[model samples]
Target: MSIQPVSRERHAHLRWKGFSSFAFAASTTLAPLAAAEISQAALALPLAFIERDGHWSMAAVLGLMPGQNLYVDAGGVWLGRYIPAALRGYPFLIGARADSEPPPCIDASSGLVTPGEGEPFFDEAGSLSPTVTQVMRFLEQTAQSEATLVDACETLASFAVLEA
Candidate 1:
């Protein structure tokens, strides 16, 4: 997915309209299934712990092939207790910049972004609107949580607990 940095200077007028359907249009599977809290995932979707390339992770099996998601219906409605945070934070993502800390970016292909529609990204005073701020916070928290999960996985691997 092509992601561009979200900037007031570049996207001062762009607004993010709500998504009309499930945003996992690019993948059939969601992996590394760690969230801010992993227990919350168990209450919703079934998870499979897997080891790949010497690293262990979890995944939620969504479907059997590309373009098919069992959790979403034909009308693009989600039919699960919890949507994956990775998917929920779609269009908006944390990506590393060339010379600065990672910044929140927007997927250009996502139809939610428009010039004159939906919720305003920035207020009249050139500040982020509540929606944008919330998204940014979510991305930041998700990144930190994912890092913790990775560290935990690595610790387990160090103990020879994960099978390759």
Candidate 2:
């Protein structure tokens, strides 16, 4: 199958309604950083690139968010080496999955975001998206600079798929 260029302009704001201690921190902090909400529209065609059964024949939601940046390692791990001071207080992973798998979960008292609910999730990629692979590729190209958290956040924002 031909690889279709994915658009990365679909910005969305995910109102995390799940329960978590981290929720409080995100709401208090991220709520202010967010600019707009893509809750009313779908991702652009380019960013809408999907492959199910070797073709672009699938139904999904693509959303976005503007807040703390996130980054994942080349080996599907969140590197917690150099987190920004602004986001250090929060539970942002360096290279980790965004699903509720335990250590990655938001503290009930802090905040909570679930895949397809508050956070982004790919049924095929789990909490990761095709963009994750793209980010990994980008990381591969530029291995000098430590992976930027904003890179992951921006990419994740471009692929935040909402549920029907």
Tens digits of per-residue lDDT for model 2, 1-164: 11122212221222224223322223221211101211211232112323333322121121234433233333423333322222322322223335842222222233333324553322232444443344434333322222232243445545664222
Q: Give Cα distance to truth, residue 156, candidate 1, Å.
A: 1.0
Candidate 1 per-residue C-alpha lDDT over 1-164 given as tens digits, one digit per residue, 9 for 90 to 100: 67898889888878887677874443556545655757887788777666755666676767777566788876778888877777777778888867987877888788878888888777888887888889889888877887777777778878988756
- Candidate 2 least-lDDT 10 residues: 29-38
Name the TM-score of candidate 2. 0.20
Q: Could you tell me the TM-score of candidate 1?
A: 0.85
Q: What residue pairs are clashing in model 1?
A: none
Each model's lDDT comes to 0.75, 0.29
Where's the lowest-lDDT run of ten residues in candidate 1?
A: 23-32
Q: Which candidate is the best by lDDT?
A: 1
Give the true-structure RMSD of model 2.
20.2
